[model samples]
Target: MEPVTTGLIYAAAMAAIATARPKWEPNRGNERQYVLRPADISPLSDFGIADAAVYPVSAAQFPSGVDRIVSELNGYGKFGGDWNGEGALAPTAESVKEAIDFIRAFPAGLALPSPTISVGGEIGFYWSSAAGYVDLQIESLGHASLYIRNRKTGQDRFDDDIDWRTVGRQWYQEKLSILQDPLQIAA
Candidate 1:
């Protein structure tokens, strides 16, 4: 092959590789996001799918709180096309695991509330419960946030750190279970 023709072929191959490669950009909190084709994450190991202790949450059915959240997670970077122009990263396995753990621990006796779920930034999820009007933040790599309104005052408080066993249990047992129950009001 002529030297010039060989050089041209090499350039073409390099260009093809570059175009096919996923674009990596910095996402929330110093993490990197690959803005590329979405991966199929259907058979997640966690979310109680393999565990007998908790009921499995699947992404097969559309619009279910759990399903929607899972779907968003699986399509994190691909869904919104470099969302917010920051190139949002996909949810980490840890974050997804944390979310599932929280849901699996839902008190069996109480009616599970349906949540409006969405991916926040890259490493976490936002869940809004219509029943008690509660907002839940599930963080994979950092602290999670939760806000519950004081029934009487109707004011909102934000807590970045939540103790699932103590404060969480208190909210579940003391306030959310009973309608119009006063929030403990984390100070």
Candidate 2:
């Protein structure tokens, strides 16, 4: 074979190998782990509920509460209640424990269903203080914000879209069973 032809073949082979065996670097920030922050009442309250004592609150209350909880827990600075933003709310250790407690202890009279926590990704699940028996699950993947609506309607639906990055797919899969039952995990 001609020298130039041999060089071209070698280059083509290298290009093929590079494309076939792509290297994936670990996320330096390691965004998969859940971060917790101090509990705040203002945003929680303003998110729309006058009192959590009520069995069923409006859906409007959930976003604000979720934002506040995420902020208090993650300490990613202020979230501005923008669902599409990349920022997350990490709860303090104590607050995380408290949140787990509250969800587990949620009154039976309220008839709230157990929550499924989707960890290690842009999608997160949490109970709303505004609605005693209701939970808010937010999913943001830098494309759009998807809210899983579990109230008002009898079916779960995607309400909207927001932009964010998703991480920790493995954590979510492993913790699926545990997240389904806070009481069982707590016990």
Candidate 3:
């Protein structure tokens, strides 16, 4: 399957949300969570807000692509065995939640990474271009693996068992610097 662009994902989400109505409910910590349900579907009892990808209204103004990523991950979390008709394993709820948290905390001004799910059910995000490539795989809530390749300098770095919660932003800034300008790093 061809990789889906963030723009396409955003467009599709907006189209779907266009016909939906918002219904608000109080969640943990008294956050005002709202679900965008289709006009035809009545509001159902809330079982798991996470399962529904419901978020507080304040986060609705999140940067572009965040909502699309959340929607995509939620759909992936609902899949069962052989979700792809090719024996691909479905991602666990824990992994999905981890991925969502990581994405929500991503630094601003950088292009949103492309979210991917491994056949073995791991959730990951990657950025690739002629300049370089970077991949971050979520193993659990705070654990992950990172792989970076600099085509210009022929340097490859892989770090496993990383705690993203502690240093994800600063660490990615250093690694992704290669993507911003491979020549500068090569020099």
Q: Could you tell which candidate, 2 or 3, scores higher by lDDT? A: 3
Candidate 3, residue 71: CA error in Å? 1.0
> Cα RMSD for candidate 1?
23.6
lDDT of 3 by residue, 82-115 (tens): 9888999999889999999998777655567889
Candidate 1 lDDT over residue span 1-187, tens digit each: 9999999999988784423112232113323323322342244466634322333332242243434444444554344434555665444556656665665455444434443335354334332343344556765433467666654556676777765634554566564532343344333
Per-residue lDDT over 50-125 for candidate 2, one digit per residue giving the tens place of the 0 to 100 score? 3322243433344332334443434422222333355433323443443433333322222233334322222234
* Candidate 3 structure, TM-score to reference: 0.62
What is the lDDT for 187 in model 3? 93
TM-score of each: 0.41, 0.20, 0.62
lDDT of 2: 0.36
Off by over 4 Å in 2: 1-72, 75-117, 123-144, 148-153, 163-187
Task: Give candidate 1 regions above 4 Å deviation.
Answer: 1-89, 115-119, 122-132, 140-143, 150-152, 165-170, 177-187
TM-score-sorted candidate list, best first? 3, 1, 2
RMSD of each: 23.6, 24.0, 14.7
Candidate order by lDDT, highest to lowest? 3, 1, 2
Look at candidate 3 and tell me the lDDT of residue 97.
95
lDDT for model 1 comes to: 0.48
